[model samples]
Target: MDTRNITYFMAVFDHLHFTKAAEHLGISQPTLSQQIRLLEAELGMPLFDRIGKKVVATEAGSLLYQYGMKMLQAERDAKSAMKELLSEKRGTVRLAVLPSDLDFQLVPLFVEFKTHYPEINLKAFSTIFVREEVLSHKVDLGIGLRGPADKRLVQVPLGSEPYELFVHSDSELAKKSEVTLEELTQHALVMYPKGYLGRDLVDDVCKKHGFELDTVMEVGSASSLLQLVEAGIGATIQPRGLLKQHSTWPNIVSIPISGPAPIRHLELTYYANRFVSKAHKQLSEWLIDFFKARTS
Candidate 1:
């Protein structure tokens, strides 16, 4: 039997009312009735039994309904699969990044990306452990300062941005365009709260220099930490790219951290074992290209 006739039969079977089924199917009731009759004639049995105004499926009709459900689902599945294969619809990509990275114009870059690929959806978030999110397979992509990620994941390096010393304009370090980590250590430090990447980086560097960091203040958030630094409470170190992000900060001097300068590499990473969807791959490539153009 034709699939259209089968579909019409199921519609009538569901509604059990010719006029209602026809209206739902966007067809005339007489046309629906004629289609049902044609299907019944082909089957050599009455699919539905009607008594006065009531309608009920017969034994044959009950059996057909069971198969009809599967048939419609299979058709839909096939169409959807084809659409995906053709890239007719670009699906969603789950991405995790650092809050500082967001200030680096990543959000606007994603907006531009979405403009080109209208069907592709990009859901982004900021968290300290972007690498951990990728390791756990909780996200499709992670864009952040690279650290010890699981070697099992594929890391695509975007570029590296050097860390700079953020001090008050009147500070001695401000007199020089470049300062060493050892020199920045002479000033009181206001670092990010413990367990943060920036804090860990500074602590590790200081340890290598045979001294532990003595933080005068530890702020939980970047904005709040910058606020304290803006008030000249203490000096801090951050990526040059990150400093540019909050470029409106007043009375701040970002001197380059020279003499064995520690740097953070920005990267996009994904699980190596899992299938990388087209959306994920495209976004990753776009990020690398965008950063290259930016740093160039």
Candidate 2:
């Protein structure tokens, strides 16, 4: 029941060898072995099977191992959250955000977060599948086009915006106030690679019309894709926010997606009911307000 015993059990369960586990724990082999024996005795079943020199968890031990790992991790997280909350002056908030051309959204939010919490170190990862990262404790927070289905995540509604078609100011598409899904398929396109959210949406629209997109180029960054468009290589489609802050770009122009447009939702998500530090709480509040403000 004691955490020390739990730790000892996990250590053994991880290494599957008493001596290595004891070495890692900085305890002697015999002492760790004795503790394991005591734990097995108290449980009324063998926790491990000794096959020659190798050790493997018994069926009961495997079940308990799962619970034990969660317990220790929860304890560690509790201590960390308490430390940050009680200290008040500084802490770290690890965040994962989709690399979905985040300059217009994430950059400003980060600037605001830094200005308010000057002492808090914000470590961010540019990634997709933001929800899984938070659940596994890989990061404390995330922002993405879509959030996780798991109940652990608390979603903060960020604004939604319609997709825009980008073309060189001299291009035919730019001459129109809006571009239809059918009209778009007439031109060659440049966009993110397949499997990305933006590309997936565009592909779906094309499919709905019983056609596939004429994607001539596939680049990774938004700026690069826009540059290619600006050079009149191909047209591109993306969220309006990706280019909102770059209003001065002379050649690139955006037109609305016509004929029943598809909109993408932006959201900030964090683990629900988990002990967050003081800085995290304030930042989460600020983020909610900031995103909600965008909606308004």
User: All models: lDDT?
Assistant: 0.77, 0.79
Tell me the spans in candidate 2 whose CA falls farther than 4 Å from its real position.
1-69, 101-104, 146-150, 293-296
Q: Give the number of the best model, judged by lDDT.
A: 2
Tens digits of per-residue lDDT for model 2, 182-209 = 8776788898999887788778877777
Model 1 clash pairs? none
TM-scores for all predictions? 0.62, 0.75
Instruction: Point out the worst 10-residue segment of candidate 1 by lDDT.
Output: 73-82
Q: Which ten residues in a row have the lowest lDDT in candidate 2?
A: 99-108
Model 2 clashing residue pairs (backbone) = none
lDDT of model number 1? 0.77
lDDT of 1 at 14: 84
Query: How displaced is residue 142 in candidate 1, in Å?
Result: 1.4
